[model samples]
Target: MDLPPLVEPAATLTDAELRRYARHLTVPEIGCTGQLRLKNARMLCVGAGGLGSPALLYLAAAGVGTLGIADDDVVDSSNLQRQVIHGEAALGTPKTRSAAARIADLNPLVRVVEHRERLTAATAQEVLAGYDLVLDGTDNFGTRYLVSDACELAGVPHVWGSILRFDGQYSVFWGAHGPTYRDLYPVPPAPGTVPNCAEAGVLGVLPGLLGTAMAVEAVKLITGVGTTMLGRVATYDALSARWWEISLVPTPGRPAVTELGVGQDEDPGCAVPCPSSAEDAPTVTAPQLAELLAARERGQTDFELLDVREPYEARLAAIPGARLVPLAQLESGEALAGLDPHRRTVLHCKVGARSERALRLLRAHGHADVAHLEGGILAWIAQVNPAQRPY
Candidate 1:
């Protein structure tokens, strides 16, 4: 659908800007009028991670007048593979600062606003209200929902993108005009079921593929020059070298969002607990678990200790004596047959999330006594085995 230019064209473009955007001016669809609109547009990017990296670069080069970068995290060494906006020198710098510095060098005509704090339920609306549109490159579900809801309330259009190991998805979401993100994903996936990039990993160029697409969508939305991806969700499978798109429409009779915090609770990736799930299974602190190990060693107690992380993660580091049982095996049900439900059992994973999932699975199978190690093996390593290396 073609949206009437969301931003009004500026009174005039400087000679430098016109020269810099000379190529855009030649494109019939995005000539001087579209270029002017882009120069007047203000966009807020919700993250400075993989997707944000490319989107920011392209948007700035395209002559967007103002770009707001909102990110509280710092550039990590691991982020270099796909977060191209930052370099090795920016390792300890805040992502917002690193990205802004890069954008400045890319196009000094583009004004950069650094939003150093993470957007919370309290600040999303106020910050988003200032922008004409939002580019949501956030990773976790909690931030995604917050961006969508905040955009809905602020009456701003957002271009959203997601990238995993070999797949990427990008779409434009506007609550007032077409389907919002809630229309695309009505319910958040259960926590721990979907792994983050840190755990699952991703192809180095997947974000680049989708992030540039996100920038194109933003350009379309800003100038109304081409049919925007307002109601269409597109997917790219890099492994197959395939691209596919599916139409998305608002859920009929779905109640309009009246507030934030819609799906925020479903993301266990965040520090907060998942309010949607009641999986408050028993847990033991690392110190308490150490005591249990000693008692078992002294022949005073007996229990089954299970590790539910992936095989690769086990190769990195693992607790001694804990039998390996990846979460996938437990979910498949065959692994349960080997375990005696009557025996006391304990579960642990990389962090507390996966082990919490395993504990729920064990309980569902009639395990009489089961508990998960609190904070998973990382906590155990910190409290019990400081010499152990972390992944």
Candidate 2:
């Protein structure tokens, strides 16, 4: 269904804007009035990577009046393959700054706001409150849920997109008008069940394709030009060159989001328990784990090194002596029989979130000697083995 335009038309477009957006003004669906609406729209893009890269550039080119970019990460050489907004000169530069510079170069008329900070549960509402619309291109489940909940609470529409390997999915979630992200994914998939783009790898051009689609939806929403993706999800498979749409309905009996940060208990995406305060579960820093491993190798002490990440992740990089027992197998009790109760066990995952969950699960099942590696393999790469490439 077509909704009213998200923003009212501005008084008029400048001569340069009229010429710059001549193609847009030529269209009956998005003529001078719609171009003015685009000029009046304020959009907040959650990440300046991958999907956000293409989406931000296109939105700026489309003449969005104000674009807010929220991202705390810096550009690395690894990001160049997909995050086209940043270049070789941007290496070690903050993603927000890189994206802002690119956007300014693309269209000086569009104002770019840089939010070089991570969006946390505490900051989500405040950060999201000022925008008319949000584009969520965050990679993790926890951030995705946070973005969705914050948008729902703020009554802002969220245009979301995800790309993995060769597949992509994009949708719009507006709690006031239709289904939300939770309506589509009530519970997050089990940790480690889904490999992120970093872990699984993504085609270089995949984000460009999907992120461009997200930009289209945002333009449609702003101008009320065509049917928006409010109640539907579109999936694209690059391998097969196929496109499919699925109708989404609000889940019956789903609790309404009345406040921010109220659903953590029910959200499986909140994988990491507060480390300092979590009872019974202890954490080992990367250095401590290294020392322990050295001691075990020297026969001075003994403990089990359990890697709770997926098989493919282990293949990417792994600790020397850690046994690969993917989190799913441990959660299902299939890997429990192999664990020996006599030895102390240390768990690790990509970072620390999934391993923390594994620690809690082990304790729940009466294994009292398990502790998780504080920062997981990434920490090890950072502190112990600088040669190991981290995902």
Candidate 3:
């Protein structure tokens, strides 16, 4: 919806600011008046990874006067594929700092605020306060909920995006003006039910496409130049090269979000099953697993090496002799009917998280002889086979 501009125009633009945004000023839709509104806008971005990378760069280049970056993660080699804001030399550097340096080079007139901490329910409102709008590129559901609730309570409009493998989706949520994130997904998905980018992987250029769309939404919201995606969701399928839209309305009987509580149920890092005792939940190291596999081959032992990762991941790289059973099927009990109850089972995924969930499911269904690989297939690649590539 095109409402009044979110930000009032600054008193006047400096000669350099005028030249820097001349391209924007040339557009009748975003002339000097709109550029000045962008200059007065303050936006907080909840992540400095993936979607945040292009969003931050474009927002800075567009002259959003004040930008706040909230993230506690550092740059890793793996992130360079899509996080374009950070370079090779920035490995191990905090993402907030790395992004700020790049933004300063792109547009010195833009002020970047570094929030070197995670946005929890305790800190969400305080961190989000005074911002004209929020752009959330966070991955985990916990952080997504926190950002949504904080924006709702503060009555701020937020642009949100999610990318997984070949699929991408984005929308705007303004609780006071229209539907919120909870309207699209009323309750958080069960832990381990959804795989993140690390588990599912993504097209390298997909984030740039979706993140730039998010930046456009922010600019439109700030200038009131176009109809914002306040009540509709836009989806993209990279593999098919198709774009679609879905209408969303506030769900009837949905409870109002009056207070924010930081729940651990959706925290990605804490998704592993809680053990009754240390011994009850046993783990096998990569070397131990290799030895056990060798014993099974020699008919000295009997066990099933269950791979709980998606089939695509297995096609990329899989441990020899491991059977494929995607985590979703395992979680839903559909894959259990085919398992051999007599054989001891050792489960694993890309890392240990998904397999731990599968282990818990098996144990809950009366399969007693079960354990997960400690560090999962990644560890096996490092310890058992140096030749294998780590995804």
For model 3, how does the per-residue alpha-carbon lDDT over 3-58 read when each residue is reduced to its tens digit?
77898999899999988999999999999999999999999999999999999999
Candidate 2 lDDT, tens digit per residue, 1-391? 5888988988999899989999998899999999999999999999999999999999999999999999999998889999999999998899999999999999999999999998877788888877999999989887888888888989889999999999999999999899989898887765445668865679999999999999999999999889999999999999999999999988988988866553433333332221133445588999999999999999999999999989988998899999999989989999888888767999998877778778888887778788998778999999999999876
Best-performing candidate as measured by lDDT: 3
Candidate 1: tens digits of C-alpha lDDT, residues 190-274: 6666777876789999999899999999999899878999999999999999999999999999888787652354542232234
Per-model C-alpha lDDT, please? 0.88, 0.88, 0.89
* Model 3 misplaced stretches (Cα beyond 4 Å): 264-340, 351-353, 356-367, 373-391
Candidate 2 global Cα RMSD:
4.8
The superposed Cα distance between candidate 2 and the true structure at residue 345, in angstroms, equals 7.2
Flag clash pairs in model 3: none
Better of 2 and 3 by TM-score: 2
Q: Rank the candidates by lDDT, best first.
A: 3, 2, 1
Task: Judge candidate 2 against the unseen true structure and give its global Cα lDDT, from 0 to 1.
Answer: 0.88
| 8: Cα error in model 3, Å | 1.0
